[model samples]
Target: MAITSANQLELLQTAEAVAREKMIDPDLVVQAMEESLARAAKSRYGAEMDIRVSIDRKTGRATFTRVRTVVEDDMVENHLAELTVAQARDYLENPEVGAEIIDEVPPVEMGRIAAQSAKQVILQKVREAERDRQYEEFKDRAGTIINGVVKREEYGNVIVDVGRGEGILRRNEKIGRESYRPNDRIRCYIKDVRREVRGPQIFLSRTDPQFMAELFKMEVPEIYDGIIDIKAVARDPGSRAKIAVISYDGSIDPVGACVGMRGSRVQAVVNELQGEKIDIIPWNDDAPTFLVNALQPAEVSKVVLDEEAERIEVVVPDEQLSLAIGRRGQNVRLASQLTGLDIDILTEAEESERRQKEFAARTSLFMEALDLDEFFAQLLVSEGFTNLEEVAYVEVDELLVIDGVDEDTAGELQARARDYLEAANKKALEEARELGVEDSLVAFDGLTPQMVLALAKDGVKTLEDFATCADWELAGGWTTENGERKKDDGVLEPFDVSLEEAQNLVMTARIMLGWVDPTELEAEAEEEAAEESSEDATEETEA
Candidate 1:
């Protein structure tokens, strides 16, 4: 239909209605309407002409204009849209070659087909505006909690009506086998917000560990006020959860604050989570201590942390083994998640057996390799000499201090130990050479003869090959795949190479090959230090 005076206000009215219904700005809808009208006008006024439309915000009056550009006589291509400068002088006192010549045009009488097309354009723009609005609103709301009504369930996925938009709580994100009917009120963590081609996706989760932390934040005033901080959280969905918290205020107990008086604060969160048991532990800077706290109700005899491997060994009394490991290892698994470590739990008896096995193994090695008697091997093992290298290189005085070991005996022991190591090195080198080990890698300073053989066996036979290896490949590491920690066996892991040592060795090799620049590395180190310093200062100020 035409933009008549009688229906001029109808355009603004429709824009307001759509904007209000979609919870978007009216200006966006009005602009969409103007463009749609201009497009419809173009179809009627000849597609070659540039048609423009303006709608008054206050009066809702529609104004249409026809535009043509003045060009050089030879450059004029379309008579409908462009005119030569000489021909434009008839319509204007002065017309520049690039200037637009605009004139008011009568509104187009839109046909049924044109009206439908214009309607589609307005709808498309409104849909885009709504999507933008939803994305903008929920993007920052990630890592937070939201309450909504369950609208429906499709293929086991819950669609939640969150006021202005719908949130999807996938089946995998639900706590256990939790089910809901239509119109059921629910609370979930906004795990992610993505703007995809179809629309903005608001992924809600009830099983996320952060969901529990946020619940405590909501119920615990100390946490909301920043007197207490939630350091970490681990959850088994509806079964159990653990939260590590720390108090900045000396007067406040972080655990007690989260637990509340008579367990009132924690009770609320537990009820909301379908009775999920929560253990609120005080966070500690010391990892082992923190792990001990994480595995509560289980008495830990000892905690040994391997920082480079990000793993920990926990020894408990025989009676507490079941408790420490929990039902199906739940307790230790949650503790590992909270501490970000791979935990290996053992009973006191088990640990003792392991130590005895190791001691016996060392004694056997000395007896066989050094040609020492059983008693002498036991004595050497008792003195903490676990390897031939240690025995060969230890101070002579250390060996002399051992009972019944004189200067001659110490010298003899060193000679035998060194002879065995020398023979072993020669054998390893021969094996490496047979496997096509390169001279460049063998002459490399850091790798031992055994290490070279191992590298050759693993197909890393050259300096370039060694330089291309990642530090983790040489030091061994843990990887999380499909949410389970898997051990990655490194070529040099058997030699007890730490990640730091592996990094240094690889970088040294790279520098020797001129693949890396020392000056650039120094500059990068300085930049990293400055960034770390700035971050620390910012954190201090925030605290």
Candidate 2:
């Protein structure tokens, strides 16, 4: 409809209706209508003129005006919108340089094309306002479950009609066996709410581990109240899942609370998950204890934890080995995920056999490398001497403390070890030089002669080459050799330097070459200090 004084009330009513339908403030809609009228007035008043429109909130009367800002003659840029103070004085008395002079203009009759243009502008504004409203409503709602109806399926992805806006549930985020039809009510975790050019796109997920955790929080009051905490959750989607819980209160039992009265609480979660098995285990601070709890139903006889490697060797009865491994290693895999440890399952008989093999191998290694007799080699093995390097590095007093080894024999053993290492290093040094290793790299503290040879063979011969190497590259990682990358089957030759040692060696080389400025380190330290201060302030506010 054309905008005129007679229909101005109708325009206000239309804005109110649009705002009500879009769930936006009416003031925003009225402002949008005013802008649309201003754009249409520009077509009649010449586009170069600055036209504006305002509508009375109570009377719904529209006013059209042309605005000009007074400026000095030298400061005026656009002649249509800016007038010099001398020229503005003719219209108003004593006009200041910053004064705004507005002249009332007769309202123009809206043509058909002008009405179309105005409609387009109003719709665009309404759509933008709706997007902003949706973004504000859903942005902070991420990680919470929202119930929606399945609106339609687009290429196997379900578009859900959430109350305020639509959300997309990708096929991969849905459970393996679950399917939905149009109008089917579903609940999903808000994985992300991202603002796009078209609108805000909400992504939903039902298979996320946090989704299960949120479900438990909804069903269990203790979890919602903070008395019990869900420490970790691992899910197999439609098959099985496990969650670890701990109680802050000494008297409260977290597992029993999560289980509810006669498994009613857990059963609710299970039903929501489409009958997926749920194991709500109690969390433990100790690593071994946690692993034992994570690998439930299959008793673990013993657990050998290698903390540095983040691995656990679990020994179970022979009959329980298959059970501990589960169908296709699912049980142990889930346990590993739950406890954040790499689990190696072993039966009692297998552990014993492996122990015997390792003992014999160590004995053989000592006897061959140290040139010791069988009895002496066996004695060294019993004393926990595995390799020639250990014997070479140990203190003479430690060797003396061993049975049948007096001071003289200890001294002799030490001398032999030193001589063997020196001879081997000398041989490696010659080999490194033959491979064209630079003197600077060979002089670096952490790069042994063997490491030097390895670097030279890989074309990393100079100090600059070593400086450019990352710690993972200098330490241990997969390397492509002979047209193939190294596999994890224990046949690759890993670098000998540790990550810390490699970093030190690289920094030392860079410092020697003056490649790094000391001021950069100072700036980095200051940045870290500032970050820590900010984090402390945030934590204090939260507390």
Candidate 3:
């Protein structure tokens, strides 16, 4: 083939058409064309030659050229790629050290192999452009619902043909009972959009809790308008789901609005979810009240919440236990997820049994630890003494509130509690000393005698050893072994310290040994004391 002005104009028109069809920039197509032609020219010309090609944007004229840079004789590694200033000055009026010397070269005829290679290059560029386009278009769609056609299914995963892109609905992301065939129209939540080496990956999900919430947002106008809000959603995917809603407008009933006129709105969401049962409940600010609402269709007699543990213990009527817990405990499990609390459900009978057992255990502990008779232990338990520490620390007035207890009896009880604690501490300190614990460590301000004993048993016999130990080692955290963090709690047995207490104690030891700056230590101490004072003030207010 011979190059002509008309053929060059036709080439540029073809490049423009290809660019339009591929949805890529025209300049990129032209660049790809130039590269392909240059590569094909390299096959005919020497491969070592510095070949370059440019296509005129205006006329589509193809210009083939070779580039060589002026260099010193010693710097010239390839004669074809570089020309000494002496040789370069022959081609130009002035030759600089880094100036490129361009020479025109004739275009080479494209063989079948060369043309195929050029086609592959254009296709690769077009694919990359498509991927970039898709990523930009769909990345913002995450956390929202999208409708698409099921293009294909591979090993249980569906490839959804979203407009201008393909989304992957992995097997696990699909609803448990839902299946799709080719060309089946489906709605899914865009869980994530990721840029990978191959292309942009749009991950769709039908089981995500956000998916259900988004569906409600679409069906319920109140939610979208902010008059009503979906506070939280928990789903078992195919079988059941629960949504907690709250209304900002006092007149609007969030649950009633979500339920629609005779449950049409919730039913719409249910229909979209392949008939999953839906429970719409109003959210409550109080945890106990919220928990009662969360466990619906079942009567709850009482709820005890442990805010520190983020746990709720619900006592239900014996007959309602089955209903409250649901089949296989799904109801309580979903309630837990919706409320963000660990829920333990029990019947009134079970709670009573547990209470009796706990009372017995506490009475036995008080009797053994403080040498109190069963009657005195019962009085202490009745007055709400759960631990020896409370007995040792409570006000004399609190102990006097026990029936038949005068100020003298209260003073005696306090005396016995303190005596017992002191004797136990003295025995533990002696044992720690016998086990070779350093006096500096035993005398550390924040470490208790029991803590010292536990440290000595763990081979932390020196102040340096105590300072070097991590808080988790002294208190509780996930156990790490073999470079893997396992789920085991590091509750340093016999010491009974919490993570915060362990950290504080370790920090105190470090400060005492001059391992930490006293200024930082003092600041931390001030902050901790302030927090303690605030907590005491809060308790006083509550009382």
- Write down the lDDT of every candidate, Cα atoms only: 0.94, 0.87, 0.87
TM-score computed on alpha carbons, candidate 2: 0.88
Which RMSD does model 3 reach against the true structure?
5.5
Query: Could you list the CA RMSD of all candidates, in the order they appear?
Result: 2.6, 3.9, 5.5
Candidate number with greatest TM-score: 1
* TM-scores of the candidates in the order shown: 0.92, 0.88, 0.87
Q: Cα deviation of 506 in candidate 1 (Å)?
A: 3.1
| lDDT string, candidate 2, 311-381, tens digits | 78999999999999988888888898899877889999999999889889988876776788989888888
Query: Rank order by lDDT, top first?
Result: 1, 2, 3
Please list all clashing residue pairs in model 3, or write none if there are none.
none
Q: Please provide, for model 3 over 1-543, each residue's C-alpha lDDT reduced to its tens digit, 9 standing for 90 to 100.
A: 434675888777877898788676778778878887888888878888889988999988888999999998789998888989899878988888999988899877888898888778877876787778788899998999999999999999999999888999999998885788999999999999999998999999999999999999999999999899888999999999999999999999898999999889989999998899999999999999999999998999999997745678999999998999999889998999999887888899999999999999999999998888899898888878898879887888887778888988778777888898999999999999999998888777777888788878879988899888887776655544894445434436345667788788777778777889989868988999999999999999998
Give the best candidate by lDDT: 1
Better of 1 and 3 by TM-score: 1
